[model samples]
Target chain A: MDIIASKLFFTGIDIGSTMSKAAVVDAEGVMLGYVIGPTGAEHRRRANMVMEDVLAKCGVSLDEIAYIISTGYGRVNVPFADKQVTELTCHARGVAALFPDVRTAIDIGGQDAKVLKIKNGKLVDFLTNDKCAAGTGRFLEVAAETLGLELNEMGRISLQSDTPVKINSLCTIFAQQEIIASLSEGKPLPDILAGVYIAIATRVVKLARQLKVEPPVVFTGGVAKNGGMVKAIEAVLGMPVSVPPEPLITGCLGAAILARDEAFKLINRGEYKLQKKQLSEAYIEFTEKTR
Target chain B: MSGYYLGIDIGSVGSKAVVIDGSRIISSAVIPSGTNYATTSAAVKAEVLKLAGLKEGDITASAATGIGGRNAGAGSYHSVILCDARGVNLTFPAARSIIDIGGQGSQLTSINETGQVIDFSVSEICATGSARLLQVVARILQIGIEEIGPLSMKAVRPSNFSTSCTVFLETEVITRISQGDKPADILAGIHRSIAEKISGMARGVALNPEVAVIGGGALDIGLILAIEEKLGMKALVPENPRIIAALGAALIARG
Candidate 1:
């Protein structure tokens, strides 16, 4: 966190559409520390803040981290990253590290949803709903707000319903209307909440089905923390789905692991050089077009 | 059975009712659709009947349309698209194309000379290009929906939005506000994006001349102007645009 921050460490920064996260790993890809927070309006500044927060939490100094890799939609905005890897690739590596046999991985993040096909631990091919909010965290957030309930409360509450209502709208806003209509129709709150998750699961599972989902499927991303999503997705997929212990940190951990691999690979070739990154809030000039 | 005919459109955002005696529309009512569609339907129906100086017993037949059409307590419900074509033709005899942009979505219907449907298309649920976003923006900006049109008209250079998704556009507007952009400029940008999306959807159908724009979205002058600019032509609007589908329902009831 400070100038004298020393020791050999690698880091991964994932500045996603909604949340910005950072993870630090030792030479063996063991996570030393990580930080997660809302991306807020200013991502460039948030990127530097997340990196410093993770390092501070780990008691590591700025100079101790040997390499840093950035991923996710806002990856390009991380000035301190030694390299930028696509989130899908990072996800594949991260999930493989967690579940070695995972052949399919689906991540429903804040704005976009993706289904990644993996071979062993590397990404094969993928499909994404990046341009829309049909089956993503945004859908759940909208539903939560409409129901006048906390976002975290929905998952557990949805488990109580035996009959989830049918939701037809795929658009997040239109789906909110459907939720309202369901509320008006005297549908139980649990049923409506369960239906919301089912709607998202239906869309994402449909995407997964398009790829002929191989078993050992793992789900990650912040949305994976929701129990309702896990249940709905499993039901829709007609197969069990596994979630990592800390699903939200997988992308950043993957980046950290990738950084470690990259650092070691470079050291073996006598090409290991730490990127000179000053983690400071000095550059506030370019907030525009950062996203 | 020959007293008067009534048509009610219980839409997602609003419920509208039209009362007609013979071929002439006597009165109409528009009200916000609250949590209960049936409740709002009754209110709208009562208001229209009262405005027309008629009682429930005087109504010969009634029909309903829109998303909550079935709950309107009418004789029967008709498809909104069919009602739209019928209503728009009645409002504007020369109109061969109808662009109905509601609160939550948009629809484009092309009709024949005799008011028979030729072809029609509905915008994707996410691609509504409707007033729903405007209402949200208005709330975020702490202004009335009525103020958006005049407020957006003052922008010298409208902010150029990069995304079409309403959620992303909303974030963009917030970002712009934080960056010290004027509300007018941001509103102009929002209108531009909405117009671009609506016009794009309209183009997917067999667009014909004398295009009539209706529904809650037509009430936004800024959106209407921007849509006209995007389509490169003037769009005709009725005096009361929200009840086009209701009028169509009324005509169907009359028959």
Candidate 2:
């Protein structure tokens, strides 16, 4: 797959804890294609397959691609990429690419959640909760398993609750017991579910506030799709939140766009000649020591 | 004539009484382990008599099990027996694993072929069990205990409240309420959440297909369904799910 060399096509790959997303962009910041897949068995293997698949679909050939930039927890494993970026940088860049007017970005991923503040498309400061899977996507998945609801359906179910249930505990175990006790006493199901959404949103708000949220703030990541969570967050911040279309794939797209820019720079330097094998080795070395 | 045996299991949250005639369980009783054992025992005795149509002298043998079992005194005797004897045959032969979900915590006990405890596991902390969650639901819904089960089934899309900790879950529930959600759905969500937690332990010991559920929470149909949903298997609720522990103790005494 190849695109005309009129404008450089950058490719960004973000391999997260639960999902992998890839984005391709032109010099003008136009997203070529945003693709996603489950983070498969191994870091490198899944990243390779997903990247190839996404690139193939967009008709963007490896030869046409300028520079490849990898980001996220699994960044080091992008076997064929030229460079790797931190999740913080990638998230800020990804959000800024979409809503350049925004200075604050909050991303809730699978195993970890983060809040970042960006200035002029550069990440200025950020806060991340990597301790447990409590407020992240995994916690909601576990909760969904318990409730016998599909992960996609929780948002809709929460909307039906008439009187929201109140859960004061922040610890997952105690909150479950509190919920169980409430169930035994004959509380409504919707209310209890509503309480749970509120709890998660509260955690997100706390993290966002720590970074000093600015208007034109963007909410990105898998958790942003949860309607109940969004509503709770909106209530807490007293502001309307913006969630990019296909929020999960934004980080990857940003990485891809960055790759395009690097490729143009390589061309300008007349240093665009390197074996794929050498490129892979250098990328791996940088990732191994990026942290 | 069939000799009537009585077994009482006093746990952290509540007490259970099971009356057995030979190999058959005539009836059972379940009451909260509120303030003291005197009142709990008396309440159990009254319930057993009411169900079995017999008085104290009719009970040929009696045994006790659970956390409060040792504390239960018959106005004089103060020794709690293990109640793992191989006497009064269990009515349900498939009940080899006994899970007690009490007020304070939960315990998983492996029962031998003869209804004796082979190994048991208990939660380490002092936390609210199914009873407390039930109370929250009751308070939120303003409905009787009998209503939650039927109403929970009505939810088309059940809310998923996540948590493995009882204390943390309380705060989560409160957050949900503040977010403009209803009480019934929250109750249903809580039921499923706890079922998942309890099932995690049950899965640890290779939960047999015909596992028996015992505890005050088991009385709630919603909780039972939640367990079934999470385990992907049907659960066997004893004649009186809450009293199974006490009844098991009684069976031990009879043997």
Candidate 3:
């Protein structure tokens, strides 16, 4: 009926290989709430959980949300999503929105890594290494587990190393062995961690170098939170890189922004009823499956 | 009387020693290489000597091979490629190609009719499909490495593991386990993955029959079957697959 008078919100969920993140935004492009957690076995169930969690945090009701966009590896499995967008586009948009001058966006996720070349606030070219997890968060997780350190502590601890050990293995499995061998040799923990960060940074930089990478690079994804990795990357690139405030939510935020834009366009065209009906049907199907 | 010959293979993961009098293996021992290669080499040699009930001085000549071959205190050293070729040929004279999957690496070698290595490809850069990868998977499954082969053989539906990187495979295994996939299926998937990797390495070498699979990984019956399936032909495996390299080393020492 009077759809124009009602306040509309959008939700975006990114069900990554290791973690799932959700973001809620109002029609005006302001982020209201966000939530992130480990992506468990069932991707569909995890997506729904994250959606509910973010909505609850924002004190928003499911009915008030106008659109929901899903991205990442499990994007297609999001039962209640109105649209499924590719993570590459979402990441580029998210980083561009944060840093308008960013020419390159480096996203290192749990299972893969991507390098995007942005020109004039749009993605021009991109390269990805989905074939392996050598430079991704999974590598760091394994390294941290092998070193008996928390994943979050790797960056800080690595900064304390005076003489960083050289990690020659490009494979994550062999890297774990190398790290273990270093530990048994009584090498300093900080040095070993430094080596791990440098190895990952070297891999990411190699991916970035394949493209025409210019300065003003933006780092996104879960791994970007590691200061040691950022420093290592900067050292290799010979340029400073900027990181978003909440690097983990960049993809989800971009998806939410897209959802908000698409919903406003529909509302403006007076086609709100069709969008609402589709979401309700999808939501019903998701509930039935969960039950 | 024929003289005794000693063969020591000080690999990255394990050290193997074989003592042979003439063509018959008198005694053999395998122990973890541990942190100290020299110490493990000495320990393995002593254990082999004890098993044979003979003193070190009784050995006429000794040869070593593997990652720690030079540092293992052997009288002579032979390349792993040469050792693998000679060792497999001794057991299966028709074997023209050998696939070796060790703890830290893997290799596929094609040999001439004379048991000399003609061409070889190694998996040193990535530990995937190596014995160490299986050991890591076993640790994650909380089962012994020996259990993987038997369990995998009973797989009703083996899962497909697309990633060849060992690090990614570990995560894949964890994800599969969490999804309530059967351990047998997971183990079978790992064997198949290893099989595909070894096959890829073998494709570079001109593999001619009889192809023999050796090294610590050959102990896994599931892997042997997978390799056979991948290559579209049967593969020969010696009775004591792990001791082939040591035996080859001993043969080299005899000369």
**Per-residue accuracy of model 3 over A1-291 as CA lDDT, tens digit each:** 223323667888998988999998876778898999998767778888999899999998998787989999889879899999998888887788788898999999998999999987778899999777788888898888766678898899999987889998777877777776676566888999988888888898999999978989998889899998888888888899999989999899889988888776765566655666745443343333433
Q: How well does candidate 1 match the true structure in TM-score terms?
A: 0.77
Quote the RMSD, in angstroms, for model 3. Answer: 6.0
Q: Sort the candidates on DockQ, descending order.
A: 1, 3, 2
Task: State the weakest 10-residue window (summed lDDT) of model 2 chain A.
Answer: A282-291
How close to the true structure is residue B218 of candidate 1, measured as C-alpha lDDT?
Answer: 88
Model 1 agreement with the true structure over B209-229: per-residue lDDT tens digits: 889999988888888899889
Name the docking class for model 1.
acceptable
Cα lDDT of model 1 by residue, A156-189, tens digit: 9999988999999757888888887787687899
Each model's TM-score?
A: 0.77, 0.57, 0.76
What is candidate 2's CAPRI-style docking category based on DockQ?
incorrect
In candidate 3 chain B, where is summed lDDT lowest over 10 consecutive residues?
Answer: B32-41
The total number of steric clashes, by the backbone 3 Å criterion, in model 3 comes to 0
What digit string (tens of lDDT, one per residue) describes model 2 on residues B1-255? 369878877664567787888777788777766534556677887888789999988888777766556555432221122342132126456666655566656666666666666666665543534455665556545678778777777766566676544434544564465444566677778787777667666645656555666667777888788878887888777556666656656665566
Candidate 1 chain A vs. true chain A: TM-score? 0.91
